[model samples]
Target: MTRLRLLDATRHGALHLDRARGGARRRLVPLGRGEIAFAAADMPLCFAKDAQTGRFELVALLALAGENNLFTSPAGYHATYQPRAAGLGALRLDPAGADGLAVDEADASLGGAGDALFTDGSAARWQAELRAVVDDVVAGRALAEVYARRGLLRPLRITLTMVEGDGQVLDGLYVVADAALAELPDADIVAMHRADELAPAAILTASLAQVERLRQLHNARYPQQIATIGLAVAD
Candidate 1:
């Protein structure tokens, strides 16, 4: 049996590994979102050596974002956290070129404080927990105190759920960049929003499955269009 090897993102780009084939093998492919685009880029990945093959197989803890970030909706789509460009509070990315946005793989200052990242074993559970924390934060809870207790750099999981919205129940995770942006009633459902505009939209992003409940609703234009939602710290 092959033991699972863990990899952390030194810089944000796509989660990729240095394959034995002399080329990089992508683990979690980035969805071109601005904030996480740089942070998840070309970082040094760590892994354990395979005793039999005498090689390292690296795997990223996070998953890649799906195209359009759209999922199935029966009662119509409810609001979820929308992706946006990184604002003032957004985590900064390393310079790609000598003066560009690219991160230098050789930079010692990169990957500062590896403690901010979670290992593969706990990534999924942590993601769900982060979403719960966001719910508390949205409901008139203090972010500073919560973050201080839990620590920041929270990872989020994009999910689809069945909940009431304007008398209609939608099956998908509805979130916003800020709690103030949410127009839905507080009692309607849990609204997961970010405190800062600069913070990455959703962490460990994943696309919801297309609605396949009834055959009559299986139309070509069902999913609508790809929304410009941004994501952060995808699993």
Candidate 2:
């Protein structure tokens, strides 16, 4: 597995981020707290364990059952609000990466045709934004981890109701457990709120409401759209 590799100008100075028709097929997008306040409103946000690290991180579901990204068109993201990590192009956030940053050296868009990643032996102008995005992701993961250890997370399963009738079932996803949160003593909730962890946790469960929006988006984009997405939970 490719571990987190930091961005080094000398090693990857020739890289360029391509934001054209590429990456439209992205399904799960790394979503961080920096944009969570808005993203929670636009897309269905949840947590899924990373294949390499086996750690849960917040993600925006672009599509419920397909590889194609519903929020993104071939030209680019069609949503008015976009995840901060989406702006990084090939350089998505990785926990193993130093400072929560990593570069896809093999990204098809890195061959100097698009925006240059490095200029004059220093990071390019856009990297400042990338650093900010990664910072939020790193910080947000800290709070997300709290949910894992504190019994605030529960496995998520969703059934799709489409024009074709029984559609795909997506499982192995996680969401904040509101019932568990209600069970916690007042002190713990207050502590989490003081530490700025409680709200985003609430945001995760609240974001589930956007699954209907997902159906709407899919319906608007595809020839055969979906009617609804039935959600089920396993504690």
Candidate 3:
């Protein structure tokens, strides 16, 4: 009789839970579609609900534990209540499971990674354009600004460190692509970066064309691996 609830920071919403069974006849609750926050591949979660009050509670049991004492369950659930002394915070659910949870307080302070992006007045126009590009990538459509918004679009920014010229030092660059562009590959990404080029920071303002190109490059270079791009929006 276990139920679950999902508090997703990405979509900034809640989701209904689905029921399931894990090992040992334990009941499990799955989150709904698009219910995750940032990265789905590394953040699995689970929860149980009180039959009477109907308030869903996060389950603290760890399906997988690491040497560092970090624990991981399925997606949509969090282990925040666990003690910080245990070093278990380093444990992550599947990246695909990152939905339905807020960025942990510890993670929020690490600006380059694990942070969400915000936008303000000065960057509003660029933000709108980036959002359209993201929408197209998520929808599996081609990129055309014909239906794009004229002004003030809010898009997320994802940054990553790459060895650009000689692999001497890591160059941190921002990719102002749609949030959905996280799965794209590097070569194709290279092209998109060229197109959606942002000034001062060289962040790529990705569009559908850029996503497609990145996908092709990704397939050619690293076929089996998935890439995660960090996101930060303007305030």
Candidate 4:
């Protein structure tokens, strides 16, 4: 059971977050634009819609090859790079709203010993770091909204086929397809560049290569249920 409560110094001053178990089993963690360049090198960045707003947002696949997280294991959580969302543990903060920070006391990570959450009637140092991550997420989404308005996004069609027969197609996800970027007029490209979006778009296009890496890792790790992944660009 989850016991979510507003973070009050009197209530949670002594509570700390356990880093190791914070984002342990999370399969899809949101990535901010600021983390893109770094994360692209470590994991595949994908786009999925927010369930509530139905607007596109960026997510990092904790496990690319399998439904289970590749970043975590029986031994322990071992991701090459940690997403900012992982640092939150059971904490939830609204980037758009003022003054409502809550934490799930139910989370194992939020327990007696870890890192102090509150110091002197206010959020501790870690909250500042996480708040910055939240701001980056908000800023990144603003840029993504611009990308959608400019028609830079296309369906990132992922085909899942069995070794012997037909399989399913996952097309709800979207991407900044390379071809779509190419189709943009030089003027538009220049404008995007001037707006500081050209680089991230390129990064998103380049990140698709990681999909095959995920498949290879998946095939190597789980031989019993192997998957063949494929991508297609829409015309």
Candidate 5:
């Protein structure tokens, strides 16, 4: 599985990414009016905006190729993988499934006509908060501090751009409010279900503490829509 992250560098006109594990570093090239930067999962990329550009919002999308890629060879596997249509029907159902389930679509546009207020929020602050969570997870520390720092009543949006196993693009928007670690299951069973149902078992079980924390936060705070995306935390 591969995860993708998009950072808003328009504010500063430049963006920088550093891979947490491979030590691969990237500096942005010039971007046009509607451009952004992308980072892949193997690389725990983090970015900062250049001070020379005008204020702009940074948006991130974490995309993952389905687990258990059938082919052994990278070339063969990639060749076999293709984007397919993600049936919107499954996502549009009302709040009633076998287990009292419900599905709703997420708002994926960065800042369309009515999203000016939300777009004004700074990505730098969110990036810093995520960095802290990453740092804590790498050290095997608890995420209580990070959870506490977030607004208790406000929901935070986390965007995801997924290319399903069949190759259809699934754009997701996750709004996280409060989060807790796996040890504290009472804090978020719904979130756990979302993680478990959508992600591979091995991936969920091996996730960093911070990943669980984010899930918990999203479950607790999100007012609408179910979260199907989970972060792959690397050491």
Candidate 6:
């Protein structure tokens, strides 16, 4: 793993990794007596390590408007952009970023704390869970076929929902899957929605199969909380 270093915005900065080196050798354009902006033109350009395969990687943190910030790869791939707000945690790359994750709404100093959770383990865990659910659905166990037809399994549409208290609410989540069975029953829909009961905190729904997988994973993670709610599978 490549640890990120905050280079001085004034002097030329470079990061040498095991396989690659990156740095900004740009001319410092003075924004103020205390702050200076490094123009990309003067910076030493570096390539981004493959996120999917490379064990070492580097990213640049850029300051944004209104105490907000953006994280991008050295190659300029936008990883995440966050802004400060009252009541709401920093706006995340995704909608559910605010729920399960604790965010500092009033404190700007706490910016990167919540960011680590999204970066370190939670993201990988969620992706693995999603893959497992997709595999299970494809094996013909749950209503995966129906969900694929209803635009409920599409990646763009799939979202994480946070449930407050003991209340239940019906909200639409987008997912990416093949279109096949659009005619789904109301009872089955209810079962799918109720699976969000796992933590009373948040749920990620991509399809009926995803819901089932979430329930099972949630149960395994929180056996005590799992006892409080009942999750039904549509037959």
- Indicate which candidate wins on lDDT: 2
Q: For model 1, what is the error of residue 223's alpha carbon versus the real structure, in angstroms, after optimal superposition?
A: 7.2
Please give, for residues 128-216, the per-residue lDDT of candidate 5 as tens digits: 43344334332211121222233211222323332332222322211123232333455354564554421222222232222333333
| Runs with alpha carbons beyond 4 Å of true place in candidate 3 | 1-30, 33-47, 50-62, 65-105, 108-110, 114-116, 121-235
Which candidate order results from sorting by TM-score in descending order? 4, 2, 6, 1, 3, 5
Per-residue lDDT of model 6, residues 28-144, tens digit only: 111110110121211111112234753211111122111122222233322221111111212122324322222223333223322232332234433343344334323321233
Q: On residues 1-235, what C-alpha lDDT tens digit does candidate 1 reach at each position?
A: 1222222244343322111111111222112222232332322111222358543222112212222212123333222221111010012122332111232233222243222323542233333433443343233123222222322222334332212211222211222223332433454223333334223333312121112211112223334322222223322
Model 4 per-residue lDDT at 15: 80
In model 2, where is the ten-residue run with the lowest total lDDT? 92-101
User: Against the true structure, what is each candidate's TM-score?
Assistant: 0.17, 0.79, 0.17, 0.81, 0.16, 0.19
- Could you tell me the TM-score of candidate 4? 0.81
Cα RMSD to the true fold for all candidates:
18.2, 4.2, 20.1, 3.5, 21.0, 21.2
lDDT of 4 by residue, 126-235 (tens): 65777888888887788778888888777778786656565767666778777777888999999989999988888877887877666655555675444577888775
Residue-wise C-alpha lDDT for candidate 2, range 1-235, written one tens digit per residue: 1233577766777767765533456777787777778988778888888889988888888787687777766455567677767656567545454334578665544566667777676554555677787788877677678888888888889998777786889987888877888999899889999988887877777888988877877887777767777898886
lDDT of 3 by residue, 19-72 (tens): 111111222222221222211222322223346854332222222111111222
Where does model 4 exceed 4 Å of error?
1-3, 8-14, 64-68, 94-100, 112-114, 119-122, 162-168, 216-224
* Top TM-score model: 4
Can you tell me which runs of candidate 1 are displaced by over 4 Å? 1-67, 71-82, 86-92, 96-98, 103-220, 223-235
Q: Could you tally the backbone clashes for each prediction? A: 29, 0, 41, 0, 8, 14
lDDT of each: 0.25, 0.74, 0.27, 0.72, 0.24, 0.25
Error of 5 at 37 (Å): 34
Our tally of clashes for model 4 stands at 0
